[model samples]
Target: MQHTNILIISDIEGSSLCRDYESTTFLGRGWPRACLGMSKDVNAVVRALYNAGAREVTVQDFHRTGFNIFPEIIDKRARVVQGYRQGPVPGIGRAHGATGLVMTGMHAPSGADAILAHTLTSRIARLEVNGRLMTEAELFCASLAPFGLVPLFISGCPTACDYAANAIDGLTSFPLHQEIRGSEARAMTWREQMAAAAAAALKSPAGRPFNPKGPFEAKVTLRKGSGEAQKLAARWNLEAHGPQVTIQARDLNRIYLELVRLVYLNRFTQHVLPPGLFLYRIMGRLGLAWIRRQLKNLPPSLR
Candidate 1:
């Protein structure tokens, strides 16, 4: 109806299709980059919003390390929020401060039939705390709804786009590709997805917001046999009860940040196979001690 300030939270880049090194069904070498949709989707939405009367826009490169999306490729006119080490919550804060939000390049929850599909980590089975099914898109949109920021557009794989649209009604979703099997996809060009996303985003009658009634519950289910199970068990200072873990976030900021930390800590395991590859790459293995120390030493503002 009027000019708006938009924010984009996305996992812009995913590694090249595993080079077919892991499984036989995996996508071919560099068939595509996971971040491509994010880069393209955001650009499309930015242009659409600007035409639709957006005054300004900020794109939050909200991944674990917060380092996706090439600057040159991203909409130069929009501000980019990067880096993973931004304290507790890695990505954007409350959308309470923004006019609108958009999510792209995000995959489905761990169980979805998408390439590199895992909720928090390969170890996480599901994360549905406080009654809400928590995907990065859900968690982020939920946090923003309270602040009056509606997620208006989304683009990614089939499961990913559906996951987002279901979470936020009235929002436009363009599924870039369909993950037919692990590492394999029935390709949908980024241009096609972006065009659809742009058309949908700029369409006059926006869809209804799938805003859930709150008092939100935070839950997490990790992969069955990943090392992150051990890490979360220790980080939250709880018992390692197989692959499932649960936690609570009282407010939007808390919920969003906690999810980031979950992704951040779980980052240790994302490379060799699944996300757990981050485990070997992390310095000091990013153990529970670090989480404990930080939790114990958190500042009043953060806490």
Candidate 2:
């Protein structure tokens, strides 16, 4: 069957009402509230798309564990894609025939001076494709291009909006928050404005795909203290250039997969841990907290 689906890729750090590590972290103190805010922001865009005559909407939970959104609170008309899955994109697959892609709650790339800014993970200090610096949005857009989908709109902070506008030609964007200084931002509570902007964007002409001509050369710069870079360099047969690892691939799919493998390789245990092993969960949380604290203490210039 032919489908006119709009794929909404949602992240937490760029949500309208989100602020601080507690809001973005899965098990942090303010996570519940952040989840609710993210759900509402997604639903607003979903409803707007439906109202604008979109046949279907799919909300991809693109945050931690791919399960941050509350299923019950999201728009019932939209199907939700949750959990970690293997694909060119985390929640996207070959079966999706999305007419447009909407990146909701997306933050800026690492080193971009936005609230909670980082690329795929805190460990990745920089990512470049063919020596061009990339934002997470650009990477995902390149992945979706094979499916003939183009980015239509993005909702996030002002930095995110500017990044999308600059990266994807003719793309529309709504800034739900504006960064004041460092991690502080002023939230824009106008859901109606966001909805209207998104609806209009979907109806407008699609933006140019961000795909780069391949064979692709990717360089990943790891944070100074992260040991994962050495491990990844050995596993991928890549050359370690101080803090950076260089990987070459013939296509975007290989590049995407390699990056994912590097970032989440250490967390494989979390998926296999038995639910009843509550002690392991506590240990994992403490370990993650320690790692984050260390990342925070890294020279601000590198972060």
Candidate 3:
């Protein structure tokens, strides 16, 4: 029998244990506790896969900066890929004989009611590939096509789970929470339940790959009032109409590259900012906290 190896791609927003922006934001008030919960969730699935007889398991921290998952608390049996990386799939290079992919802590696309819902980044208001609305799960699944691996399991909010299941045939999805309104959601299951579901999904047959045909056309709608949209359009030669930008490519890889450029265009500031700039950090924290509070106070209908 062939030894099965699996790759786990994890995010933090869809974690049932995470309830607020502070928990998912890096260096925010509840970030440490949220990181611990995210680590435990990843570790749970890792141990389950090992118990189910998987020889090797690798985890890719697919969240902000790609370093959200705590290395110290992760399962020793599983190797983890952390930090920022570039490619069709950031932080994930060659699949390396992995038979399956598991997406954990995923949320719905932008404008959805799932907790911290956003595609690629909060800067994007909407994203469409080849005229079809694209989600992070779909993009990652297509990127893994060259390696012949498929998304075997996904654990996330209900909307995200449904999206993945609908996009990939035979894909198993475990819902950690159901979004009630905007960032508000109710946890549906505990960490142990999620682990069991993931292991069972992995042991099942491999899911079909969701590989879209080539000659992809990507349409990205930047968030309203964004200051970077004009600059991005000028730099990339993208066709811009108001907040929307379009990139035409012959393949998915190029489309992915274009989207990456748009998403991280302003991220370079982090590299130049002095480490001792405590005041700036404090201001940013306050601003983010205020925005989160406003979102929390929004009516359910508006959310």
Measured by lDDT, the strongest candidate is: 3
* Model 2 poorest 10 in a row by lDDT: 180-189
Residue-wise C-alpha lDDT for candidate 2, range 68-151, written one tens digit per residue:
676666778999876544445554555276868888888877666667778889788877777666678877887888777778
The better-scoring model by lDDT among 1 and 2 is 2
TM-score of each: 0.64, 0.79, 0.79
Task: Output candidate 1 Cα RMSD.
Answer: 11.7
Candidate 2: residue 103 lDDT (0-100)? 87
For residue 134, what is the lDDT in candidate 3? 70
**Candidate 3 lDDT, 172-286, residue by residue in tens:** 8888654421222223236677888888876566565557668888878888643556778877687877778889987675687678766765456435534423444455445
lDDT of 2: 0.71
RMSD of each: 11.7, 7.7, 7.2
Backbone clashes, each candidate: 38, 0, 0
